[model samples]
Target: MDARASAIAVRDESCVGDEFAPDIPGLKARRFWIRNSGCVIAAALLVTLSSTALLEPLSDVAPPTGPEQKKPVVLARTRRQSVTSPKKARLWMPRTGRPETLDLVERMGDGSMSQTSYFDISLDLNENASGSAASSASAVAQVADTGANPFDLVLQDALDARQLMRHSGLGYAADAPKAVRPADQSNVTVTPAQEAMLVRRIVSLPVQPERLRDIKGVIGVSEQDFAQLASGLGGDVVRKGEQLDLIIGQRPAQPNLSEILFARHLAADGRERLLARCDDGHFQLVTDHRPYDRMVAEALAHQAAEARSGSAQAVPKDVAALQDAAADYPKLIEHLARRNVPVKVSLQIVQLLRANGIHWSKTADVPQLDFVFRTAEQGEQELVSVTLKGKGRDRRFYRYVSDSGKPEFFDDAGRSVSKTLMHKPVSAGQLGDGFGWRVHPILRTRKFHNGVDYRAPMGSPIVAAGDGVVVKIDSETGYGKYIRIQHDGGYTTTYAHIEGTPKGLRVGDHVAQGQVIAYVGSTGLSTGPHLYYELRVGDTYKDPTKAEMPAGTTLRGRALEEFRQQIGRVETIASTIRATATSAAHSAVSALTPGSDKQ
Candidate 1:
């Protein structure tokens, strides 16, 4: 067509306000340029129009009402400004400090649509509905007299979190890759709203015996110790590759000490931070790098600010009473270990309590506190709750003064639970020899067999019989590869002729009842792949199947109520942290290889 004709066609179809040519569906504000004979072009004209204009048939259709009608509004493809000199992007959401670039907003769990707001999620993170403060003061005083050191207890508890693995439960996998949520992303959760929901769930969860115990222990720290505890526990959220935020599920929140009372997280550096949580919720630092006092001062200032704002507030903690409980915690555990109580279960219980906020702490110095309970077997002893032989009141020592004039407290210890035992260490095996005198297969003489033997394949997994520390893990001329675990009540169990334990595990490391400690094999003196097990009461060995050890005990009265309450907590957090089912036996792990640690 001629220039004149082409011009007329262009003007009629796409000229300004032309009805014949509809706007493009995708491009928001499109600019069109008209040219004559491909020589010179007129200035481009930018026009704003709807994206749905092109799809007239589909765009005209209305969406369903009610639930099905809920959907994020799709912002049409907007025509960007001039390519020669574009404008800078304006920041919107504070989390990323960048303009919204996503195609569409995600739907909430309730199927409701949400617009991009200043924060990642609009749910208020500072919402706290806890009353632990009102009761904590009295409880703290009661526990402080019990000699619990809250600071030391928390520090040691981290070391002991791994010990809780003794109980067979699913939890955070030790070998699982570190979860470092990116700054723009939420922790293990998908969004902040979801995280808030999880926090709510955790809050609604009744304080279990273990967690209450832990929380109590934590609250007992001296103010001085509390500061130290904060520093020690306080560090950049990410250690190595493991993001503390992901581990603790702490996302950065605006640091408003006046609004957020408790210290949740304080920034460690410009980008990273240290996270903490209370029964209520979490706190965060705005900028990284602040002293411990600075954060606490915020709470103090917040308290004052609240007072000025004329709002009711709970008093902040000034000291740590459970400070002494730290020393007493392990001591109490040791005492139970020396007794007929299941040491593994007891230690785990202590660890669980240590890990939680228990209100009570018993120390050796607590004037006349002696725990008395019934034994699990024939040798067991059960008595009425009465004054002991030399009961005397000692107000100077502790507050719980017994009616018989002694500041003594009595309660049932150890519950009637399954005795820690490995029915079969080998995944697939059979009893080859009984625990008694037998004709020595290799020695060719009648000798007393110290342990029962399980004949199995060369490389089957072997677990601990009960919870205990591996006192010895070495090989000898007779026992090829052996691991000896010292249990409660002066009892020690040995597994001989095993492949080996994993690296990182040493003699002092703790193991759980069902934790896989070794792989079955013949290391020392053995005919084939067989596990030689030995149960020793002090010096003399006993039959594994016949000997009646204090397996577990049942709690009654208040203690039972405490246990029933505490188990939920122990299970709640512990359930999420799981170890590899195979232990050091994983194919690629650095476990002791076959014949590697032979004595």
Candidate 2:
């Protein structure tokens, strides 16, 4: 369109509202009249705009609408079961930190439990409904002597539980239902609102045995010695005074007393005896005497006289006969070897057999004997060449077959398979501290330590015991910068005093076995930058060395058999710690616990 026509269209739209525009072409002529139409349109538009502006002030004075509505209301219910027989029941909920009040219900034998119809007991912190300070004091007084709570529930944490019971007085031990056992009489004497929970009576041996029978020649012997001997014999030592009680049931009876006295058979003489009787009722074998040999000898001599008419063919001195005789022999030949035997005669006997035809057989992987002696003196020099086959199970028994289908024997102490057993990854480090009661360097008195302390340099990689979840990671009062991993089988372990913890590591993170989680550090209450390690069963701290560590699950079936057999050979390696007794074993085992170099 021409400029004149465009100008006219714009003027017409701007002036009146463009309602008068024609849709047809040739608007060019209209442009020429656009300038003329502009003045006319401006005057008309001014009148219209002036009228709207004048009327706008009147529109602002109108009235308002109703007030804002509130949100819709909906009634909902939250349901919770209450504890039935609240007044009569004495319940205990065990946990750490805050104690939660739970509604307890009693379950019947059929798996149905009694429920509270509708009753909620509200606890008021203020006023008389609140537990009294005097009641708290009384609960403390009651539990102080027992070392446990009277509510039949011990706080998962004993000390913390006692403090809560003392301060809150939330439980009524006096109201506990009558004890179901003989000790229930004590419950009736409990005072009201008092911590009347039943405390497990400490089991102890009576002050003395009522009957003091006339006895003589029985002297107290070391229980450890007895235990060691019993273990070597694959039997347990139950100690009586100077004598250990032997429990010999009839597995298979020996030929006679002569068979046992001569160490020809290991079959029992058919008797079982309880060893020692202690004040704590804890009995162990008394390994102070060799009563078995003498008893068997006497019994054998009597039986021999009666059977003198029978064919007393010369017994082929074989390993089986020796094993039978030594089964009831009180002299612990095996224990003596491990703990330094003083018997020179036994050593000479062993040397003679080992140097002679008694060579180790490759077939059974055990030593064999091929000589028989008519006299104990000839045992040192006699050499009757005859092939014999057998497997050495102990120092007394070598079950083997002779060339003539007859079992032959020797009087040599058989070596044990377990004697050569050694634990894997032998660690070569000093044991700094052990788990259990020790004087706290900071506390200045005895305290229960839940873990072990390993002395190592900083930045040492701390390995995970097994695959587990990192449940906790924090620096606490005594434990500085600790990491806890929850493993399977209710096992949990902690590694503390870590330096340079890996990034992105946090709680709920899964870790694999042998994964490096952190480095050693002196972060918390440590004496130096060493690793402090702990093993917990559920929440109870246990001696890491004593606690059964989870071995690789892959080592099962044939793998486990091989592993066990391998360890059998491994245990024979002498521990780095000086072998003394109990303390030495603890020290040796501690080297394998966490945070220490176990290799």
Top-lDDT structure, candidate number: 1
lDDT per residue for candidate 2 within 1-599, as digits (tens), equals 88898677666654553346565555545544665777899999999989878887887342234585545545455332322332422222222111111111222225432321110111111212213333333333332333321112112233233333222222224334444566555324454433332111000111122111111001112344334334433444222211221211111122211110111112224243323333443444444222332222222222222222321222234222322322322122232121111123223334334333243323234333221111111122121122233453533322222222322222222211111101111122234678888998766889988887877777777777655678998888888788988864457888887775788988898665566788878887778777777887875887776554542212234534544443332121111001111221232222223332222
Query: Which runs in model 1 stand beyond 4 Å of their true positions?
Result: 1-411, 414-418, 551-599
What lDDT score belongs to each candidate, Candidate 1 first? 0.39, 0.38
lDDT of 1: 0.39
lDDT of 1 by residue, 1-599 (tens): 78798567565654455344556642213324432322332222212123334455675355455666656666454432322324434212121111101111212235433321110101111122122333333343443344321111100112121222211111223423355458734223442222110010011122211222222222222233234324544431222212121111222242211121223221324243444433434344433212222222122222222223432221123123222232444333223322222222233333333322232333222222222121121222221121111225421110122222222222223333224345565667789889888999998999999889898887888877765678998889888888998874468888898888876889888665667888888777788998898889988988887665542222346755654443343332222111111111121111112322121
Alpha-carbon error at 322 in model 1, in Å? 43
Model 2 stretches astray by more than 4 angstroms: 1-430, 551-599
TM-score of each: 0.27, 0.23
Q: Report the alpha-carbon TM-score of model 1 versus the true structure.
A: 0.27
For model 1, where is the 10-residue window of minimal lDDT?
195-204
Say what the RMSD of model 1 is.
Answer: 29.6
* TM-score, structure 2 vs. true: 0.23
